[model samples]
Target: MTELAPDAGFRGNEKLKGALLQHAALSPAGLSERLFGLLFSGLVYAQIWEDPEVDMQAMDLSEGHRIVTIGSGGCNMLAYLSRRPASIDVVDLNPNHIALNRLKLAAFRHLPDHASVRRLLGEQAVRTNARMYDRHIAPNLDAATRRHWEARGVTGRRRISVFNRNIYRTGLLGRFITIGHLIARSHGVRLEELAETRSLREQRMFFDSRVAPLFDKPLIRWLTRRKSSLFGLGIPPQQYDELASLASDGTIAPVLRHRLEKLCCHFLLRDNYFAWQAFLRRYPKAEEGVLPTYLQEQHYHAIRETTDRVTVHHANFTELLARKPAGSVDRYVLLDAQDWMNERQLNDLWTEITRTASEGARVIFRTAAEDSILNGKLAPDLLDQWHYQAERSHALNTQDRSAIYGGFHIYEKRPA
Candidate 1:
């Protein structure tokens, strides 16, 4: 919010297009890229999929460390405040994401108490949220961010009204989950029941009995074959290719099934909020289950006190990094953005990362496939400056509760 210049809405959309539109206008892949860009230009993730707890562990975050990260849904960035970082520089190509990060920071600074914050962001659908936004949150927001919330959505409601409804069910990812639920219901499967499972055994039983079979359905299988069908999951054309290649049969169903299994069975539903979003379409009640770190009560005061340390920029990661002084940042959270990059973009990003990274800096990111995207893609000279913690990455990847990404990677800068 601090560095976002005026007309960011236009500039961010163009930047998003440049990042996503990798092919020509006439080809099938090009068309899919265009379509994805259009949808991605709007609000995509209502809740970020990467598990911030895993991220914190991988980065070994310490007090007073400077961090740079992609601002998706804004939860993880705020959650990082709990570690007492000296500062956090958040960059994103989506204006909606920029507005959202700013809004969340303002909510922390202005909202009266923890319950007020929770009701607005956690219990997102309460009617009082709109009133709360107008009374407490709105006045504190920067003009660009305030305008973003006041803008009307396709439903002809001010975007802020999404809180009055189910905010989690309104974004592109939210709509995607809704469609998944509808499809499952059409087959007479209730995904919500997975949330009620008492044990991992019960979770596996639910998946084996109610969920896994859907992947084998002809309609479901065919739909998975289409790259566009996954745009809601924020999978772009290049990433779709990476994910499809992971399956021995050259299809995405198996990969989807594998990730969904991890989400359903590997983690307890009582603890994983990502599963709650996927199945229940909203976070559980405080008395019922867990919430993201930023939304939890214990972290509220810490985050609010440190809200001033965050700066949201409507810009590309590499571009933002290029502006920073050498050896300045201690941690980097890419959050799967490299999966969208080509060879040149990857190199440009790493060049800046290596240039800007502090001694012993750690970088964490996720990928759609079960390997670091940097292997063979990033230039050897730039890549050699960093040491890949393959063993630790594999260990942490398993601990990520979100379970959507195929791999979690950590790279530490070698002593210069």
Candidate 2:
């Protein structure tokens, strides 16, 4: 893809920015202060924090079809690329994310070698990363994206400076982690001592007694239940409204509890090298200035090759599906995005999905609520052609890397 110039006529619109967040029910002060850091800073949900360890047992990725996904932080997109699909199209509404994905792709493709690539990205802790970006990464960046990274923080300081400090307290999830630490402190349980706890049972007991009680508190519940409060986690007001619709009384404590439980209790915390990056390292693994794989040597080459066929876009799912040729994509990774869509958007997405699906295509997505997104809402005509493995989805979900999701579903496209 060819590079494009930054918009010369573009001007900051203060009024529009205010109203957009307000319309999303976020306060102007909160938007400018707390939410700004989450959006602008590299404080992402760490989408790849836990390898999904997507089970290749039931699905055959070598079938060689195109793939479409929401490129939240680009980790999963890159992870899926390891499977060697014919092509991958990644779309996201957030331009920051788009730019970030582009940066990763460029680094992976042009960096001296895998080791250097790992040093710059995987380690992410090298003191000269900003220098490397200025030298290698930034020069290659498109004008707009270059400006985006350059405009961040102080001059001569690269964007990676956020990691040198308390980056964990930066994003939505970061704020939550901060809150968790505070709560842990309040209960006289220091989170820094997690390693001291020798057994899983001890970890569970400590979490249940100390952290879990925070969710049950009326004040925490009141604050977190609001849409604006969750902006840190990048949950827009629209998705919050849908989440309200899913619950009986719109109380979010249970949902929050479940996610927090997974974060604290699941093999996720133990096996996830990404989580280790957050709680353990302020930055990702960077060798000299390259990024290393979370996996061992065996999976590295396979994963890197997947990068060849991957393409990231700044588009909506429904629109992308509408334009796709019939029976094109093999796997769909929609990460809890449907909770933000309306019935029409849902229908449009699935319509094209069923129309374009090859036989036995597997579609995976998560939901904000425990209920399946497609349970009864989808039209039977379109629904009949797909198989919903509720039992299997439930079973497979136990293996999901990030336990934060409410539901993990797989829809197998039936014969046309």
Candidate 3:
């Protein structure tokens, strides 16, 4: 598997706090921690979770703003490109992520048209992906990224061959969904049938009849309690603790059930691409408007036209910020990455952010719990410079298409 064990975009603060940020791949807290660490160290997310629509709306990007964002799966960076930002800088510590971002950039720059791009990433089972890569995308890629796609994965096949199969269905989240499907089938539940619902009533009935009981299963309950089973979902140990603490009685199962209800019930299956991927493991074909915003046909030309505006870095966000002139950046998208940080690390990150944020800069992030995490950990003097839009945050939380997170916060820099 492609290991990202050290690729988390972490700024190693002194005191080894950044090292503490990622649970050790070899020496975890326990057996569960080790396994979870191993899973996290791989291509954990072939896609990012935080909704880019929500982020874009929060950032108010246009032609002049500069954005420095965490490039999880590189989806959001492409999404940002669609908005015509002056420039976008994407950073990740994960070599796998950096490679993925580079591959995506190469695809946009080289592909002949929209359909070929769609076939390679959207429908899968393309005959010409490797040929296209060799003649077009591959030649444009940097050596490290080209090497990553050419390297063999578990199937004794180069990872790029997954484009000939299903790329979305190949990563850690993909495997996790596959496992959930197997577990559901063992209990006579057909998860895919949930997609057939015609309306909200049908969706709720299907969940009540066919889906809710799966949550109560003794095996699932046991796994959810184990903590490591969550590794596939990209829930690190620290975030898992915050999730457990937010529960009414400090149990994770009910909390998950509530979130799943929002995912499966609150949104229509026809348009909710996240739900489509969760239950079906692949996005809707090109005709459906359910592909990621960056992949959708309407946005294709705009995203491609602006691909040069984005630059990917295999470095920490702080590293990028340190090099920028003071107040050069206009917006930030943290994406619950800070939930992994400790006080000293948080302080260190904010110190740089405070120094580098442009006037009226806005920062957006999500957390595992319903409350903002910066309250106690951040120094009041530093924290006081930004206004936490609590009311707006609560409203946005309800709108986040990804129902996995508990809180969505928007903090704008107070006028200088």
Candidate 1: residue pairs that collide:
1-312
Q: Count the backbone clashes (under 3 Å) in each candidate.
A: 1, 24, 3
Name the best candidate (by TM-score).
Answer: 1
**Model 3 per-residue lDDT tens digits across residues 1-416:** 12342333233212223324354445555444445545655576787888898898888877889899998888899988888888898877666677888888888889999887777767767877877777889878777778788887576987888788787886788898899999999999988998678898898998889888888888888888867788788787888998989666535888788888888888787777888888888887645438888888888998899999888875676667888889899999888878878787788888889899999999999998889999898999999999999998998888877788899999999997
Ranking by lDDT: 1, 3, 2
What is the TM-score ranking, best to worst? 1, 3, 2
Choose 1 or 2, whichever is better by TM-score: 1
In order, the Cα lDDT scores of the candidates are 0.89, 0.61, 0.80
lDDT of 1 by residue, 187-251 (tens): 99989888678998999999999999999988888899889999999998999999998877656
Which stretches of model 2 miss by more than 4 angstroms?
Answer: 1-51, 55-59, 154-169, 183-189, 238-250, 274-297
Q: Score residue 414 of candidate 2 by CA lDDT.
A: 83
Per-residue lDDT over 1-416 for candidate 2, one digit per residue giving the tens place of the 0 to 100 score: 33322211112322213222332326554344334433433435544443345534334456376778887667766666566668889976555567667767766665555665555555544565566566666677666777766665546665556433443345556666676567656756566554444456876885777667777677667766676666656565555665666556556666767766665567534454543443444342322112323233355566666666777765667667788888887877777777655566677778988887877898887776667788677778888888987888787777765566666787898876
Best-performing candidate as measured by lDDT:
1
> Each model's TM-score, in the order given?
0.97, 0.80, 0.92
